[model samples]
Target: MTSVAEWYEKNLMLHRFWSVDDSQVHTEYSSLRSIVVSNFEETIKMPINEPAVGKRKSQIQEYVDYYSGAGV
Candidate 1:
């Protein structure tokens, strides 16, 4: 494994779970979004899946599996 630090440094970003990809959200409907929409910047929605999730076609998982296979 590359260690969490290496992976983070390469592909780190901040976003909210279940939040839309748009630049901003208007009021009133803002609270409708279940997850928080603050300055969260380390959640990966790419190259993904977690072992815990059983590889259900996730971009995040692919990235992890790829790096794990690469021996880093």
Candidate 2:
């Protein structure tokens, strides 16, 4: 298993973006997307999730509604 520290180093040394090919595109919605990062020592891991499209409202809009106190 690769240590977290090693993973961090590898990420920095080989920076790349994750993307999908146009031919593989689908109309299905993903409710959540996450990005995780850690400290240099790998002692802390911070994971962030943003909303994706859904049947009714997007996750991002829910966050906005909560933060804005719109109660939508």
Candidate 3:
């Protein structure tokens, strides 16, 4: 996620005071390596994910499990 962090840092001005859109953040069934990102204001949405291998689970799988379990 280093690239994401770097991009966020570089574009901090554009995302000023933005908040996560819990309802829209989810994984698509068609592709496990995909993530949907949205803001609380619903002004913007984006998909960010990459193929990665984990010890026992993929990164996207872990994220889906966490958010789903947390009821987000």
Candidate 4:
């Protein structure tokens, strides 16, 4: 999870459109970890997200808007 977040932080172009709050990322990661740990048998193979508050629009929200919904 940490590595994935780090890679996104360094390489994702989404940042160009919206600023990601680092504190939000940390909180999201912690929450995600707790969820994953609690459901060890269930594997999450696709992106699951909610629009996170930030300085600008949320990247996740932008994707949902562009696509009109979530995808697998």
Candidate 5:
């Protein structure tokens, strides 16, 4: 979990745009290197998001922009 968080902190583009303190979010499982934020006991889980960076805007960014904020 620590390693995953570290890698994300070092590589995520969201970090570039916002001061996203994503240390609380860690990957518990990944068949495709996707990001899955969940509780520590594994009782609750959020949707799995595949980090996609391209020349154009990504879906995740659009979602964030639409909502105006993110959630746990």
Candidate 6:
């Protein structure tokens, strides 16, 4: 995905599902890291966060998992 998209997904998309109030702001490519540092940085860099208490499914994760596994 493009940098803009990545930024939006991490911030905007995730925020809708899980945000601390309405302040679901995400970085504009500022949160991104190179592959070499991504693993370490990704851990510390938070996204919008997952819903605190529910079995609610993330549409993005759901579709990706379904389509990717549908070959079976």
- The count of backbone overlaps in candidate 1 is 14
Residue-by-residue lDDT tens digits, candidate 6, 1-72: 235335655654422222232124223221211111123224433332221222444443354467773121
User: TM-score for all predictions?
Assistant: 0.23, 0.43, 0.29, 0.36, 0.32, 0.22
- Give lDDT tens digits, candidate 5, residues 1-72: 335444544664212111222233333421122354444455554444433344455555566578886543
TM-score of 3: 0.29
lDDT of 2 at 47: 46
Segments of candidate 1 deviating more than 4 angstroms = 1-55, 69-72
Worst 10 residues of 6 by lDDT: 29-38
Better of 1 and 2 by lDDT: 2
lDDT of 4: 0.41
**lDDT per residue (tens digit) for residues 15-57 in model 2:** 2223233133323653555445566565665444455555555
What C-alpha lDDT does candidate 6 achieve relative to the native structure?
Answer: 0.32
Error of 6 at 40 (Å): 34
Q: What is the total number of backbone clashes in candidate 4?
A: 0
Clashes of each: 14, 0, 0, 0, 0, 0
Clashing pairs in 5: none
lDDT (C-alpha) at residue 13 in model 3: 26
Model 2, residue 22: C-alpha shift (Å): 15
Best by lDDT: 2
Clashes by residue pair, model 3? none
Instruction: Report the alpha-carbon TM-score of model 6 versus the true structure.
Output: 0.22
| lDDT score for candidate 1 against the true structure | 0.34
Top of the candidates by TM-score: 2
